[model samples]
Target chain A: MKKPDTAKQMTIARLLLQGNEACVKGALAAGCRFYAGYPITPASEIMEAMARDLPRAGGSFIQMEDEIASLGAVLGASLTGAKSMTATSGPGFSLMQEHIGYACMAEIPCVIVDVMRGGPSTGLPTQGAQGDVMQARWGTHGDHPIIVLAPSSVYDFYELTIQAFNLSERYRTPVIMLADEAVAHVRESIVLPEAGKVAIEDRAGPTVPPEWYIPYADPGSGIPPMPRFGDGYRYNVTGLTHDVRGYPTTRKDEVEPLISRLFSKISKDIDRLQWFDSYYTEDALVTVIAYGSVARAGLQAVKEARIKGMKAGLVKLKVLWPFMRQTIDAVMGNSSRILVPEMNMGQLSREVKRVNRGNCEVMTLNKYDGTLITPLEILRKLEEIYPC
Target chain B: MLETAHPIHKYLRSSKKFPHIWCAGCGSGIFMNALIRAIDRSGLAKDDIVLVSGIGCSSRLPIYVDFNTVHTTHGRALTFATGIKLANPALKVITIMGDGDAVSIGGNHFIHAARRNVEIASFIINNQIYGMTGGQCSPTTPHGVKTVSSPYGNAENNFDICALAEAAGASFVGRSTVYHTPLLDRLIDKALDKKGFSMVEVISQCVTHGSRWMGLNSPVDMMKWLKEHSLTVEKAKGLGETERKDKIIIGIMADLDRPTYNEEYDRFTR
Candidate 1:
């Protein structure tokens, strides 16, 4: 196949695209061929782009009836061996939890893009909030591990989507790209990578014969080779905790091994899974921890604080799950205090404190009014504590 | 000779699991038997077919079948079947669901799958009531019928599943009752041969739930009631609107050809 030139293509060059559009481009660039989604606010553009582009790109696009069916189709399409994805906001994401758990337990590879909006219920349909940070980690019933990537900028929206698909395919679990309204709607100049320039990861397929292939058989790497349906390999997959053959079983011996692998697969590979960008961390007195849209405000605050001659730094988390405790601890170990700002009521702050273990004083700046936390607001909180 | 000649009965036993999960005189078992007979006659390898079902008494049919089967959550059987079919378009995927399972909780999946024209045989056992959940009014329950949830009588008009399937773009749509065993069997045979979305809405009788709640006492009585009340689509066409009012139409409602979702998807991917 001739590699298409992407670097020289700058038709509009400055054509306005939302963060959601960047996500679509990223998914398409990452080899997403199947998109199943139900339209929801602040996230619908991702579906719209897929609908428009998938057909032309020789891919499939389905507008499912609701969020549950959307995720259901996505999981179904992934099993067919297509790189599948679905985008939704809060309520839709909530409905997708059960299937998300199924994806986790069954080890299905798929991408779920959640454009965070204000919620508990239909709290703010068109607004932005980061309240689902914890839910993304533990919303589904049962013990399972997941990878969540938070993208702060429109550029990260493109990059994180590719990472999300790669992580999902590599780990054989659902990976979430958590974006908020600010990030989702924000338009910025982003240089699109030529098609072959970016790395695309496909799920590992079964190398053994049908009889030798156990769908969930531990390859000792914690992830088994996933065989797509219609490959003449007969294997059963169930949502219930099951044995290696994918048959449902309640045996204690079988259950422990399966659950342990589910955790270890990601935990052991945490280095490749953790993604963060630290700014001016050397000799910093205070570290500000944040993710998604709030990280933008935190970065700006750090920049402003630096002008005032304060030794404040930013620890922006791109990979929010697997906690990245080692990196977080390493970054904050020298700092006397850390300021964790988020849209929710101190969810990630609690995580910071838990990981810090009283080594540093942790302070939280929470705003739940469906608006972006301003850089000035974070700077004021930092000044109140550090008093520079 | 004919009694001992059926190939399905040879592979299947008449023992305890023989009579199956359906109540004696329930049409579901008769339809199930027809499905087995069609499969046996199709000459497809048993290992090549996978039967999937959602939550319902009818959904339990796949569990009893010796072939590879999946008993999934209510209404999501088609989604799982789609997964299996897409992974291997060569695998003959069949999904069995009930009225509430296919149309109520799973209605969105049903219409979308049909619209996509996914290549799978979808067998919907429309027993009128939520049989497993103790006779709640279902999407197909007759208007003004009183059930546990509709003590004041169901005010909602039921979905015409055949119409819904046809409108949603299913390549094949057929309706039959347990009374017409031969026709149901023939339809199943055709559906198995058809390459796109083939839906067979078997107007089954939920004797335990519908009979007790609707004041129809026994399975035989319910079967008799279905025979008396149901009208063939052709027969209904000849009758006036008033005469055909509240009548159930049984026959192949619509049949057309459309590219199956998987086939189109495969062409794209390939």
Candidate 2:
């Protein structure tokens, strides 16, 4: 096959796109050929875009009966060698938690988009909150491993969504893109990445023939090569803790290694998984740490603090799960105080304190009234911490 | 002379861990026997068949079958089958669910799958009790029957599985008891060839838990009860409604030509 000129496709055009719209574009670019979702506020735009565009690109789109079935379909399609995804919000996310655990236990590669909205049960459908950070970590039952990514802008939404698929496929696990309503609905101008410039990852397929293949054999990579259905592998996939052959087993010898491998596969690669963007933290006394839309406010707050001759910097986390501890410790080493601001009752702030190392005074600014934290509020916390 | 093995043995997984979990005389084993025979008769390639199931004793059937199998979460097998069928329309997808797994927790998915008329063969093994989680009353449990959950008596009315499937717009619907194994095999064989959603409600026995509650002492007694209560659809058509009360109508209920979801989707997209 002749290689098409990627340079012509790289003719960059700046266009205004909503974060959710950008997410759909990224999914399609990442070879996501299957999407099954039920409409939920703020996240509905992502589903709508997929429904309109997936079929034209020779992909499939389905609107499931509810969120549970939506995630079920996504997992099912993923097993058939398709990059599949589903988009939903808080209430819907809660419904999908069971299947999320199934995907984790079964080691299926799929992406889930949860647009954060005010919750505890439909608290603020139209408004955004960062309340689901902890839920994203522990929503599914058991100590199974998961990867979550957050985006701060429309551009980040596009890039991180593609990254989410890559991580899930490479790791053979579920990856969640946890975007808040603010980021999902916000429109911004971004120059689309050139076709060849963006990297896409497909799930590794089995190298051996069907007779010799063990469906869950780790083979030293901490991940087994996956086989698609109808590929003559005829292997079984179950949610049960199974042996390498994929039959349900309760033996301690089999269960222990299976669960450990699930965690070790990601923990061994924690350095690459802990993605963040730090700004002006070289010689700062007070550092602001945040993610999603709150990070945008943190950046603005640090900028104002810098202008006022205060040593302040920002660390915006792009990957939220496998919790960015090493990065937080590095930030804490240089800064005497850290202000963790979020649109929830201090979910991520708890993580910051857990890894504080007692060198810095870790403080939190939590707003749970279904609104984003403003830069001024963060600045006030910084002033209080510095006592200037 | 070499004696040939049973035809069904060829379809059993080489790695199948058996001394199967089902209690002695559980109807799921009977259904599995009939299913393999039916598949053997149909002559479909094992590689092209995908078997999906939800959580229950019946759902465990997929692990023993030599095909692409997925044992999914409770009450979500149809959704998974829907995805698999759409992702590869050429693959024959079949979902095996139990009473609670199908009509109770997975009721919404069940009806929608039928309504979409997706090309899938869904079999609901209605033993009328939650066998795996102990003998709890299920959605198809007879009203006023005693169960662990319904110690006094079942307060809820039972669902008519065949009627529900037909009402939900399934292209093919059938009902047969484990006693009628040959008919069950034939019905399942026909369902496999259906181009859209097809379902067979198997009124099988749950001798361990369900029989204890129903006052049936043994598997033979339960089989006798099924034989006495079930009437072929043609036989029941001549009987009055009063006479047909509580009778399990057996045989094909509906078969119609409809535009399947996968076919319609492919036509428009291609």
Candidate 3:
């Protein structure tokens, strides 16, 4: 077993790792004991790494028949109180949305790693595209409070996967580590955290006895303490519209509260749940809203635009869903236009438009040829939006 | 009334959740009752048994019982059950599925799970048609059966589920109809006790839809049909080939001793 390097006394050295490899190392560090996956391009490396490493750390892995079964197993392991996860891209990710809804409605805390690939039907298996940005938020039908975290760099890939697990546990919701193919396959040297330096928070256990405990009871925090299966509670968990006691119900009064709670749980805590970084938008005339790999180019364009005396700034989204509206408000509030560059035809820009609410022009620099948006393209778009 | 209700109520959820959604003549309730009695008979700790079911009348068994249950998506109960068993080997995981769930949309998972021989019990409610979706022809719908999806006749041949499970390497396999309550309950008990990927294919009757279309509309008729059509394996062995062609051979089809996946996993990780 690898010793915890995050301990203050331990000296940690930098390791060169692909984003996929870093994700496995981070998940293991977060106490993930079960991994269920189905192989798909660009994301399959994560499965391979997890299969090799998770078993060594006393964890288990299963290559399920399909993505639906993969997430199903992940949720089952989670019900037994194991930190579990699965990795997929494109078609496989689409297969998982049904159970992702189950995880949300059942309030199962597990991580889903979507290593974004080009799609609309296996369009480009090896290519990176942020087409799933909107899908991550609204793909699973019905009103659901969802969390999607995007990582732009190798270090962010490592750190965000851990963050995904922590947020999922804390909120009792499935967290999406939305890394693009670029992030998953890109290799970079990063300073690995020493063991114990990274904080690990497991899901809270029920304090009350089985008799008094209601499985879905929310004492206004909108988060209920979960009892692991076989811990003597004998409570129930299902996909049905259930009551506080976890029994099926058809009452409108009961249905509204359960459905409302599902959305309100995260919407109420947007401050703690939302995370992003903004640059120079306070004084700029235009801000480019970007996330995932496109955000890397957005940051570069912002710097280059600034050197050439164009008041160009960037808001790189680290947390995509339950989107940081206030963050965009801070960045685009002072600007005349917000330039949204992405591999998809403006998926996230639509959300920016919804949240920005005509406060500024939400123009998009769209690319869908199975390639990353170059810094030059973003810079050119920024110049066109607000010529210096 | 309260005293008498307590015995059955102890195995079920609150009264408000009852008058269960099951139709009047369905045999799924019988299967559910047998499952509950078998658990009670085995004296297994209630908290240690997790019931995971897929969508359908059969999958709704977990909705009535008071165990730690999850009524999952259509056709994926075994996948979830596999996870629960692998996560905590001490817990007894059981998956409740319909014929459509186990043999059609979920066939890959059904076969893979049996092949792995994971220590989880699966109960397949074979009602010969898709009961949930308005009596459509299912993968296990009998040959030449007429229904909404197959109004003329079912072109597909039914899957002999016990043979499929045994072929897929399930360590224990059994088949019994709801009419044979004692034997069906015993089948469930032995399957649960086998310590591997054990399965009991219960020949449940869906009276409202498929069975009604097949002319077995009432509960009495469905039960009688099941009893008359199915022969005990002992009796089946004596019959001539032509005489046994239409009978459902019933009994523990396979029971063998082999190392279970749970113990093997522990050893490999250790």
DockQ of 3: 0.77
Considering lDDT, which of the candidate structures 2 and 3 is the better prediction for this target? Answer: 2
Stretches of candidate 2 off by over 4 Å are: A1-10, B1-4
Go through the candidates in order and give each one's DockQ: 0.29, 0.82, 0.77
For residues A1-388, what per-residue lDDT tens digits would candidate 1 score against the true structure? 9876667554424446789999998998888888888889989999999988987876678776788877877877787688899999999999999889989987889999999999889999888999888999999988889899999999899999998999899999999988999999999987776568788888899898876666788898999998766566656666768788766577899999999999999999987766899997887889898999889999899999989888899999998887988888887687888999999988888898898777788999999998889999999888888834
The sequence of per-residue lDDT tens digits that candidate 1 reaches over residues B1-270 is: 446775654444222123355666677778778899899889987667878888888887774554556667778888777766654567798999999999999998898888889889999999999887788999899889889999998999999999999999999999888887877887899889898999999988888878855588888787777788888888888899899887778888878887888778667645
Query: Per-residue lDDT tens digits of candidate 2, residues A311-377?
Result: 9999999989989899998998999888889999889999999987798898889898987889999
Q: How well does candidate 1 reproduce the true complex, by DockQ?
A: 0.29
Residue lDDT tens for model 3, B144-196? 87899988988888899999999999999999999999899899989878878
Candidate 1 stretches with Cα past 4 Å from truth are A1-18, A120-126, A192-199, A250-257, B1-33, B43-52, B61-72, B79-93, B112-120, B134-137, B141-160, B163-171, B205-211, B214-249, B257-270
Against the true structure, whose lDDT is highest? 2
Q: What is the lDDT of residue B50 in candidate 1?
A: 79
Q: Residue A287 deviation, candidate 1, in Å?
A: 0.6
The digit string of per-residue lDDT tens for model 2 on B135-192 reads 9999999899888999899999999988999999999999999999988988999899
- i-RMSD of all predictions: 4.4, 0.9, 1.3
The docking category that best describes candidate 3 is: medium
- C-alpha RMSD by candidate, in order: 5.2, 3.4, 3.2
lDDT of 3 at B123: 95
